[model samples]
Target: MAALQTPKFVYMNGGLTAWEDARLHIGCESVTRGLSIFEGIKGYWQPDGSFALLMLRLHFARLKRSAMLLHIPFEHDFDEFSAAIFELMTALVEPSRDMWIRTTLYVVEGHWGENTRSDLVLTAYHQDKALPEPVSLGISTWRQPGDDSLPARIKASANYQNSRMARIEAREQGLDDMVMLNQAGRVAEASTAALMMVRDGVISTPPASESTLESLTADFCEQLAIDRGYRFERRPIDRTELLIADELAIGGTLNEITPVKAIGRRELATDTGMLATLRSDYFASVRGGKPHPFAELTTLPKVSA
Candidate 1:
């Protein structure tokens, strides 16, 4: 895993600023009550040695939508936010660096039912670490809430506590990660990533309506599958589906395409599978080694090193 080494700069509140200078009051409602929404985005090093942010437009859209859902009162328009992020990415001395960016909007001055003040904080860091492949997984006892209970599509910081608990339990169980189910006893998603499985050469996953977060990576994979003539479907998945899946993998910005080697002694074939092919192609697309339609919208030209 990549350890955070504080970068020299950050964009906080209203402008580009010093990283160390950004601060939040200890007693602020957003800080104390977990009233915030954020997005995690990955930027890759292109073959031309310039950096290209993966799915930048989609990520910004989600961030704004999440803010709206949570009533965080984010004021900047998409163009403004995009320009700020592009400026930050170009300011890096190493243009070929792979990096992670997080943009957050939260309430800072509200109590209970009072009027709230909001702010934005953007922090980015070099992401040189590569996660290990063929990760082990365990099913968590924690059930993810459906949309009726909470907005499952919003990227709210408070919503992550559910995943955190599942992660803790997975650690205790000697697993790399955990899979969560929805209230209807249907497979939802992994703690931090979207889940996909293969059975009889067909790729299938639970739909977002089944309480899974709308996953950009998963959607990308689905399109990739369709374009390449591979079978893919979005439908309700049950717990028993995991046991019978011929192959399994998780998708996310950070996790990317990680094959599941085993799930509670039910070993999965990972050496040669459809997921392996998709993973390679996905990585190539992100790094600009292959043609991907989304790249045109997702990447911005680096103006300076």
Candidate 2:
């Protein structure tokens, strides 16, 4: 894939700013302490010369929950934030390609222990929808932070250090990604996505209680499976279970649906028809080929011809 082009504009603190000029102080808590909450929303290009933001409301809802959990002050309500997102998309998004819109709420001033002001930043760039080939995964030595420590439920920037370390370990091992287990020795998730295992036609995934992010994409796919008459279960999965599963995959907003060809050195059956069907159905649903029950399609304003 080619490198992504930077967007010309970014929405910052209730107004539009040139991307190069959007900046914060070097000593800001967000910079020094990684104190920020964020969300990745995909905007699918439609045939009508517009783009539709998938799960816009749900992403914002998760952002709000993250803010509350982390004690970050978010002054703008849903309507205000939604309007700002649309404004940003209008300025940066094009109908010819899909885009990944990222919104971040971060501390702008003050030290770690003090009350700090927060700013909202929204930026977007084009993204390709093509799915990559099935990947190999290895279990990382790093364990996901439990709720008692740094909770994985909140989309905080600080939580990514754990993911980053595991990803680096995977790269060193010549694997695509790593599956992180919780402190309790159960499967948590992949470096940046939720893990799912299929066996005997049953789709199983670890619940949010298992030190994993409450993934919107994972939930959407689970719903798709249930609607298609596939039995879906959310429970603690053992490490050995992944090695013997009929199929494995990871799901996220960025990684829509990715099949796992192997775990560690053990290669599993990757030719299952179930994974392909889910991947196809997922892309179709997001691109408006079918109705989406959970996410409301917020269409961007049409650009003048």
Candidate 3:
């Protein structure tokens, strides 16, 4: 296939190479019809010139599921995948710089209509910028697609169109970001991240049953919070109750646990709010290795290379 007129990229078609120079047929199903899946992974740096991955294993596990659904066999070795990510992240994340990583899987080639092919790609990008602070949000005038409707479970390239439409509408309306609702009109998630609401000293997020992607960072935050003795609950959330909640956070790989101050017309109480310490602790864990989780949950190993 003729290459895209873009800058150089590190692409792995079973082996890593400069993607712009890699060879693939135009009939590659993944390229021709978006027959691929991908994941976004993030890592951050510490004062010691080292870096840490946020929810690494969780992201890979999700990637495997995405591959299975697309029938794109993920043939790479696990340890190799981990090492590649480490090497790639270390190369991409400047020492003491915050970063984000993106991994992709695609089909090399097949019949125009056939769905099964085995080709893979990985790309990681980041800047020294800090994670976006939770800013004021606009309740989306748009809604999210149901899980059954679009294989919302798979992080397909196409899913973002839905998210894009909502986000564009929100931005045009002069909003920072918008919270999209499910077909049920129940509060689902923000166009980019998962939604959380605090009530009565508890941090609550809507269940995955309510979202397309069971967000990895959000789940990790909830688990870490619970392990630290904070009560974290997952349940179907009601739309009206969002306004009265003590605090709200949109959780994701990059967004982390930034808190929200308001929704639509109802002004959510921000000052004298209860989630300050929890938020601090979460940032600490993400930006440094001091409070690493007790168990080996991520593909990242105990010893750094």
Candidate 4:
């Protein structure tokens, strides 16, 4: 993972605040019980010196849904959320640098099992554009929690404990990342991304029903695949199938579309250029090189005097 470039300012609650001054009480539910939900958004610095946010509405909609699911009482509408993000970017980020932005809604003042007040915090930092690289993966012993338990679909802070454990296991095993399985012992996703495999010229990924988070980046890749006349399917992926797959990749806001070079000791075939093609298309769309529905750009708002 790339280190974040610390910003001079951040948007907290409703206004701009110094990065050092943005704080939460130690006793808050968000701190004690991990009662927070968040969305990761990417911003591209166009060649013309303007910033464009990728899929702004889709991310915010998911953020709203996450708050609703967790009962975080996120009352801010889409417009207000967009305004705050733009304002923060205008104040904190250089216009020529690409950035990664995180918008989090956390329980600010309540104990467990009580209706809580929530606070919004938006943070953005410099992020450089990089293409996905091949990495090794291990099948984790840690299984993803089912919807009946701590669901994997919610982008909540508490849910990441599962990912944290899996990542630790992977590191100890000397692998780049871990592929988590759902309750049914089927492939769920990578620790922080949605996994996709290619076999027989067809692209396949485990469905959201299989306990994977509904990923915007994965969806964008699927659309690009379809437009390029490649067949795409969503189904349960078995462990054995991964070992012999022709190609494998993982996609997310941060991972983008990373190719998996190996699963355990078995190296996947690299001759197939499908992952490369899709990744190129994805970057192009995000940078406004290609026109697509999901890549609709949101420019910075005008600053008021």
lDDT per residue as tens, model 2, 1-305: 26767789999968999988999889899888889999999888755555788898899999999988988888888889889988988887654667888899979976765777899999888876566579999999999999988999999989989899999998899999999999999999999999999877888999999999999988898888877888889999998898888889999988878889888888876656676678788877888788668756788766521
Residues 175-268 of candidate 4 have per-residue lDDT tens digits of: 9999999989999999999999988888999998898998888888889998899998999999888888888998998787788889999987
> Which of the two, 1 or 4, has more TM-score?
4
| Per-residue lDDT of candidate 3, residues 239-286 (tens digit) | 777878778877777677667766766656544454665566666676
Overall lDDT per candidate, in order of appearance: 0.83, 0.86, 0.69, 0.85
In angstroms, give how far residue 291 of model 4 lies from its true place: 2.3
RMSD list, candidates in order: 2.1, 1.8, 4.2, 2.3
The clash tally of candidate 2 reads 0
TM-scores, all models, native as reference: 0.92, 0.94, 0.84, 0.94
Which is the leading candidate under lDDT?
2
In candidate 4, the residue pairs with backbone N, CA or C atoms under 3 Å apart (3 or more residues apart, or in different chains) clash, namely none
Q: Candidate 1's residue-wise lDDT over 1-305, tens digit each?
A: 45668888887767778888878999887779988888888877677666677887888888888877777677788788888787776665365457888888868887873777888777888865365478899889999997977767998887788899999999999999999999999899999999999998999988989998899999899988877789999999989889888999999988889999998889988868888888888887887889688644356554534
TM-score for model 3? 0.84
C-alpha RMSD between model 4 and the true structure: 2.3
The local lDDT score (0 to 100) that residue 109 gets in candidate 1 is 81
What is the Å distance of residue 239 in model 1 from its true position?
0.7
